[model samples]
Target: MTVPANVAAALPQYDLGAEIGRGGMGVVYAAVHRPLGRAVAVKRLPGVPASDERMSARFAHEARLLARLDHPHIVPVYDYVQDRGEHLLVMEKLDGGTVWSKFTGSGVTPAWSCAFGLAMLSGLHAAHEAGVLHLDVKPKNLLFTAGGVLKVADFGISQVVSEGATLGTHGGQVLGTPAYLSPEQALGNPLSPAADVYGAATVLYELLSGRLPFDGGGGALAMIQRHVHHQPRPLVEVPEPLARVIMRGIERDPRARYRNAETFAVDLAGAAAGVFGRDWLLRLGAPIHLSPQVAAATTRPTATPPVVRETLDIPVRATLAEAGTTPVRLGAETLVPAARVLAPPAPARWFALAAALAAAAMIAVPLATPGRDLPVHSADLSKPVTLGLGDPTTAHLTLTAAGITLADVPATAPDPADPNPAAAGPTSPLTFELPGASRWIVGGAAVATVTADGKSADYSLQPVTHPLVSIMGAGSAVLLLFALAYLESVLRSVRRRRAGTGAVVVAAPLGFGLGVAVWLLASVLLRHAPDLWPALVCGALGAAAAVCTVVAARRSALR
Candidate 1:
């Protein structure tokens, strides 16, 4: 085989095989470690000039960042070597395809969608924590492992965030994949982890609907304009709860969206759990089942065509041993064959139903007793509480208590800009610190202190988030949600005389019950401190979940 100039350097350590993937950055070749015989993918950056100082450092920075991150969902980097001035980024070879490579017109199921989101979120969360930001997040950037884990890949345009500094120092001046750019990013404004949130949400939206939220047939510039100002098409195909989660995640206002990728992921997992419970991940299963068209698209020549399409390893150990001789489903949209649709276990179904009934019973029984009203206005908030603030993050809150001479509780108040969400809304604002808001935004510290009479006093203050309200409201929400599911199942079963209809009917309530039950318990336990921001957040979530029940039932009926 004729070794390309870029492929020569890797030849010593890695037996470079056929080219499997290519992009504007460079071509990707399959290579086997000479000593270990481990399969890997080596991407040689043809665009990065070995002579350019800034570009070289930037590329090196990206390589170091990826190498530092250790997460199952983020692809690991084995080595970054500039073989003769041509940068070669050797990575743990993934066999599953990219999400875009196998995106089918049929769209992704809710369980799979949430699972994929969770995997991606887990990776992004790790990146954010490590002070790295994935500026370009899109379907193409997400690769699946042979085992079907969605791994976040491609930090080509990523940058490191300095401690306490919320803004990024790299990739700011340049545009990344325009389709997934956050509104703030598109406008060329300062960015935080929230920008990545928008990108993840965008790709997830595409995965769920099998289409881009903002379709820009008009052109790239026009599409950028739409991304900046456009409202996405309504998500009626998905269950309403899932739809609301997606909508909120992609909110135009960064604040309106989940504070970070973590929150976005939690909601997705929560909603999926409600529908699929502990078995949600299983429901998503794996994806090697690619339609011929999608599989073909991955390998087809383009202006910047990838050498490998969906590595079935759909982009993997089984990475096309022979590039074209073997039809490899290289990248995955994370869609398994429809034949593998595993129905919920019988015991799981019953367990979900029983839990739902228990919740409903709790709510119903409480209502019959006098003075059992939920506590909305009443909550205990007399104690002082503190949450941890990591490096580059700080906190300051004024404590005023008469007769309780306070110790040096910083006379300074937390920044108004970084107001506590729990302090204001019916829900407590999630504790998220922006890298850009080090000097201003006030975040809760991990350790809080409230001293009496100029000395530190022992005290435990719970968030005044009204635990009664949280519990009672959660119970009521779940009860209503279950009722809606049951109604829908009944209607759907009657209309569709298909075989195994009873199982479908039973599964509807069970899926919804598990989801609602899990959500209820999580809400109650997590909101024990009684923060308003989360309450409001939970309220919005509840409404969305309820709406999902109605829409899902209606859609099932129509189907």
Candidate 2:
């Protein structure tokens, strides 16, 4: 927290106090303007020495950029200082601390999270419109005002996107927090507004779910790889509509993500209204500021109908015997305000039921279909026992007093173009001698059971497809297709910006699809007709994944 003597000595007009924070950019110190008696945060650019011309240019660029961004949610710069070998940026001091410091994984409510997002996004959109991208939009950069209004800070690593030029990266390395970097940003590709959108979405995700979208277990490199190649584990406990918005914002492909921060903010406001209520913003009671566009979004008709039932006026018939109050009630009786009931519209209710049924079917089909076992056929090994009846047989099993011998047969015919067709085959068949073995597995399944005498064996032929396994396999294919359809639906629905959807739309079907695939593969390999447990496992995974995805999405979406 200590500043260099020269840095303190350079700023004679202000009193530099203790260090507030430090990062790769520079160290920030609390200060007070002597003349104005105004508190401010002075960031000393020790990393950018006055001797380094390129660094100095970048420092000057940051000052100019910060000065231009005069929005309410962005930290406003007061002065830039360059004296001797030291460079510094002075800005308004926000004493309420940062989101990371106070609310990392705090599991804040949806309305609160969305309100924070609105303020952050409003500022980001303003910056974006001015051709600046805050590449490092992480929780730490989100500082709250004393009134609890969130403001975006630290444009040190921000890039100014102008005509065909970008300002941030140096030496092929992008500067930003790895956990929140967009896929393209992680890959050092040219960035767009979508990158900031991705970062902001990640911040909101953390605020709601109390976790980063990608874990930084393996360090920055691993996180970057995950950002580029992996989908965010679906949010848990988050509402589907809000989750969809976040998902779209953090999509791997920039083209697939939200176009700008303002658009994202509007969608978030709309989603907040659907999940919490039309007066969600009013109810939030958090002193977060909202731009006009975002505030307008709250009144827009949500894609989904209101989830909670409208307040109903029910008439109460008061009887002289039942009423504890005075029995003077007469005429139309009393119409009183009952307890507020929360129920979805009838159509929404039915749709939820249908989704539940579909998810159940996905799990049930795999468990219910008990595949038929392959019949054990006795084979006399005295004569060569062919394993498969085909033009080119699977293998030959020979049981002798010495041991059991299995020889592979060529699966392909000799090339007619070869001058020596006979020589094209292997000099000797590939053979394996299993000494004193009572069972043999082929192609990942136990296909043959040998007798103790070793002269005869009970063998299930290779490629013996069980009708049930085939059915399950075929069903798996269907589930896969269905999952694809669901994914498409997710994308389409997100584009339409609908709200009030449960987690089933995206997470449930996708999980069911994965379960179907696992069940089919495991069932086919195990080949035990009665052991249908794999189906149950499949179902369990599907259910658990649905729950996990739902939970994750829910917590992340609306909290």
Candidate 3:
């Protein structure tokens, strides 16, 4: 098919600099929008179609569908026009290539593939919510941006399969790429959101495994037949959880598959997060029922009852493989155990216990002989300690109190430029002074072999508290004020509903008023009482007002 003359002329607005891509339906050009000062993609529809009316209508419908959708992961429709009687769509041009390109080459990592799937699901969910079905969803329609954002593009072949649309199937008019088409779509059954779910799964499978589920040298018809009847090979090469999710998504029966893109997204996310498990159903609070097949798979063989052992107090369920040829013996009767056995204490716990023991030994050994004092040493503080206002950095020092006079406690150099260094230091024979010390205590060394007569104790230093009530109080006040305003708006909405007013008309002003009030209060507080104290006062006032309003509203509702 030749490009339409008018479409060619309209392409200049987009600055169609170079022809970049071509497909069965149209050619995509690298274009620049002069006024917007940004590069864009221009897709020009086929000028002449063998089936003129149907194809043109479909193209126009797709453009309209793209215009209605506004989502981050979807290619934004910038402009659409017919110049010289030819159709063209100007869209956000992505620098990175298509998913197909990546898959056929050095395939993306599993993390990237998962991210791509999520982006596609998010875009598809938005489109589905807006009552549009992307009839053509394949790797070619998914684009990667230079900034690493994934976008779903090519809505030109999308069908408005929402409520109040035409309901007949176009026989022998399969719309999507054959390898990714759902069984229902391949059979020419009426399309629904599940079809998209199936296609998304196929794309995800291809991304992880680097191969399509079905391919044929014969023709499109052969591929469609395989999609309808044949079960694709299990994606065993991919991670188990991901493979399971894809298999479930591409289930032959539409009813057995995810009901919508949102469900698919949730399942895919679970798989990617490594949370996919049989217990997920239990976690979701779903009813537990074993199908006959599962029940049979788990059934244990009947054998002579084993003798009970005294040491084994609990009956342990063992797998068939672990059961071995001999019947395993159980212990004497005991209380039914909890559903889940508690895991053994972790290595961290053992390490913590050892640390505690060491600490206890350090303390107990030195104090066992109270009169014989230990020498303590100070920490090296020559290196600058980095700390925030409320944060503290501590250093340990040890000195022997046995030889040193009680009055000759080790003196610490004052923090330069700070007059209140005494407040930060310790005030005892064993503990020395350090500026900005919240608390200080002398403790024995972790090793106990050293004698207490000259062994020094370690001291831990922390930051002193600097109270600033106004900041915290003010924040609370602002939050309380907003809460009150939100409540007022909600009450107004309920009143309007009760009075038989439409939701939109009543909600608009209430919502606007609430938002404006919040902004105004926030701005006032920020400008005047930037400190904690003033903010605290405001918070108290807001809370009081909110409580009063609630009381008044309750009285009004009662009346």
The residue-by-residue lDDT of candidate 1 on 247-313, one tens digit each, is 8978898889998777776666655444444443544464422223323322332232112212211
- What is the overall TM-score of model 2 with all chains considered together? 0.54
| lDDT (Cα, tens digit) per residue for candidate 2, span 241-276 | 777888788888888888889889888888777777
Question: Listing every candidate in turn, what is its Cα RMSD in Å to the true structure after a full C-alpha superposition?
Answer: 29.5, 18.0, 26.7
Rank by lDDT (best first): 2, 1, 3
Error of 1 at 187 (Å): 2.0
Q: Which ranges in model 2 have alpha carbons more than 4 Å from their true place? A: 48-50, 105-107, 163-173, 306-559
Query: TM-score of every model?
Result: 0.49, 0.54, 0.47
Worst 10-residue lDDT window for candidate 3 reads: 442-451
CA error at residue 318 for candidate 1, angstroms: 26
Off by over 4 Å in 3: 1-5, 163-173, 215-217, 275-559
lDDT of 3 by residue, 286-325 (tens): 1212223322322221122223223222222211111123
Q: Which whole-number lDDT from 0 to 100 does residue 258 have in model 3?
A: 89
